[model samples]
Target: MDAWVSHAGIFSATIKFNEPLQVAWVNTSGDQVTPGSFSLDPLKVKSKRAYINQTVPFTIADEAAFSAFTSAMITQPNFTWHLTSDKLDVRALAFPTAHGLHFKKDVTLNGMNNFGRARLARRLQAARDDPAGGIVFSATTGLDNSSAFNVNLGTGSGANTVIKPGSNAVTLDGRLVPQTGTDALATTFELFTKYLNGEQADVVATGKSSIQADGRAVSWLSAGLTALELHVPFVAPGGAVSPIKAITIGDMSLEFSTHAPWAPVSNSRTVLAAMELPFGFGLEIEEISNRGRCRACQLDG
Candidate 1:
């Protein structure tokens, strides 16, 4: 016969960011996560029965975890949340409140062939014919019939490229218009082209390529447990050690608070620097497996 054992006590927690080439993990401190601080929110409806299942809440451990959590929030970077107990391990992904666009290379005209190919060819031919004459190329911003940015290549292709918010506008010459700032479609084509070419003009005039979260916001948390391991000790009737069984939780959500750093603050003061805003997140579990083995039986065999 095998006797079961119970594991119930305080556990350790760790949080880590999954970034390219570098991963950061922070341990919880007493100041960050207080004792008996874990909780789940109750779902409520105006005229219906309330659901008691929703988001879980917990405080960060200390100044270090708080600082790290703050950084992750502002940067909108990806991170992993972990909770470890004597017999269980829980984990989840904490999504960012905001994200920005990043362009890896410069935009050029040679790549576009649909709209301006013939007109550009005519301009080049005309320029060659009159050595003293130069091709006139100009661009402006305005709403098209569809209320999108009207991008004219100034060529006689009779084709107009329209740009919408959160979408890229490709010119007749293969230039990529960035989808950044509040009103990117209002930006002049000349400035838009220059900015994509790595020119440092007034970003305000061209529109910002990135923006941070102004206040507390929430984002999606995805795929929960990357790995989970549990250890359960078993005892035999004769007081001898029996097989040890390992159990794992397949799915769970790990939610917590995270602050967006909209303004800069001095890091010298630990308390002031460690403040974090509220946020919630959850991660889905992929799979779960278990196994049991008896050392005493193995030795006897």
Candidate 2:
């Protein structure tokens, strides 16, 4: 008898910016300029990573949405473009069929600018007048990878700030690692307990998550502690048991840290922002049985 293993599932996630991000633009004079701090809307993503080396990509192209926000900022006479802080904070929630997980990640990067081109200035002017004619920028990060680098931000180092022409292309690359803290885990436990006790109705109603399994909606009081574990069995040929051929399992884990004003206090149910929870699954194959029966098997038959 021979058997094969399989695992499949889906996940829904919501990402939100926890704090205002400073924005800056530079002119041809090479001087750093400060625009104003801006906040982004929440983004919802649904994806599945059933194999290793798979990456999830997202893009936004709503010029009108950005134009409406920036138009109001430009009206302020005191508005200057500049990065207010060196750190960025974001919060994320991942609700998969396996479990409900949360993450908080803090990214610190040296600010740089490249908006010094006549063409770029013209494009900026056009973008201000036309809702469909704004700029588009993108960024990507390794969900399950890490890297290291040494950087110097002091004046005289040409690498201190990023530069780009106004009408040209720009790409910024840097290492971003998860922040260190215990608040995310504490929140996860609290939420799990709430889910197990039928107190997650408010969480679900807020459009934060929907918990279900086996093609049916699931409640905390109904699943108990086993809500996190999902199992599926495969029967062997001829109802006979033999050595396992393969094994596949899903891996779901959380990584995050909390800072002042965002961290939860004792007995508080507040969830922190600035987290990354990269969850996925993979398979491993073991020994393969021979086409012909082994001596022990033949004798038994």
Candidate 3:
């Protein structure tokens, strides 16, 4: 039972694939950036098994198809990946034949837990029960990404994450991104070279982010919480029951890792910006380089 997941609340689903799949692509090999060796022809894909909500084995019956899929991943310099689009060539996805099942019966979580708390007992029993064919969780989500990165330095210990007292954590977080520089950013392989040579990668984002969002139609939402911040209901008061119709946060990018012994950025004497609201216009105020909001909520007035 293979599963797929994302930054979404956990849920269980049972799906029945009542049809076969079809897919097509163009493949270009060798040193020359020429036409695809494989034509863009839709090929049929047969399901060996379609047991939803379970960890089932799915195989690509066609040998070349399987190889093409596997070769799709050209990983970055480190064990990292950027949620950027310019990465994959859609030309390879010339066309696709989906075995899209009747999505009606699928168990969706929107109506789920709206009442709160999945009983602990049922959760435990679900874990212990047999006939509980393992589960495969996958969801289709339209994605629009600007920039993202995954940096794994091959060092995995609580100590690697330890930010020396008073020292900035971003200076040590085993990763870096350049806001401005002439040198081409290092690749995953090149990043590894730096790690071996004790070189530095710009990891720290120096200033607080600026944002303006229409909560009603926000295209993206990302946030973080350092040791200094906590999860709280952050909403604007539009007259007692304010609907923060929109929101924005420190810049738009979010750092995947936070919480270390870094300096308290909020404590910095440097005043970045100062703005005052004329009383009842509700909103949130935060410090730079520190954890702010991590989750967005849909406020229903």
TM-score winner among the candidates?
Answer: 1
lDDT of each: 0.25, 0.27, 0.24
Candidate 1: tens digits of C-alpha lDDT, residues 1-100:
0111122113322222121111123323412221222332212222222223333444444444444443332222223333222212222223332222
lDDT at position 139, candidate 2: 19
Evaluated with lDDT, which candidate comes out highest?
A: 2
Candidate 2 lDDT trough over 10 residues, lowest sum: 117-126
Residue-level lDDT tens digits of model 2 in 202-290 = 21110111233333322221222121121111111122322344533243222223443323222212322332211111213374322
TM-score of each model, in listed order = 0.18, 0.17, 0.16
Which tens-of-lDDT digit does each residue in 1-301 have in candidate 3?
Answer: 1223332212222222333222232233322111112111122222322222332223334644433322231111111111111111111123433343222111111111111111111110111212333221111111111112121112222222221212111111112222243345336445334433445432211111112322231111111111011111111212222223443344343333346323222222332444433222223456445344435423255
Better of 1 and 2 by TM-score: 1
**Model 1: runs farther than 4 Å from truth?**
1-37, 40-53, 73-77, 85-301
- For candidate 2, the per-residue lDDT at 10 reads 47
Please give the TM-score that candidate 2 achieves against the real structure: 0.17
- Residue 63, candidate 3: how far off, in angstroms? 1.8
Quick one: ranking by lDDT, best first?
2, 1, 3
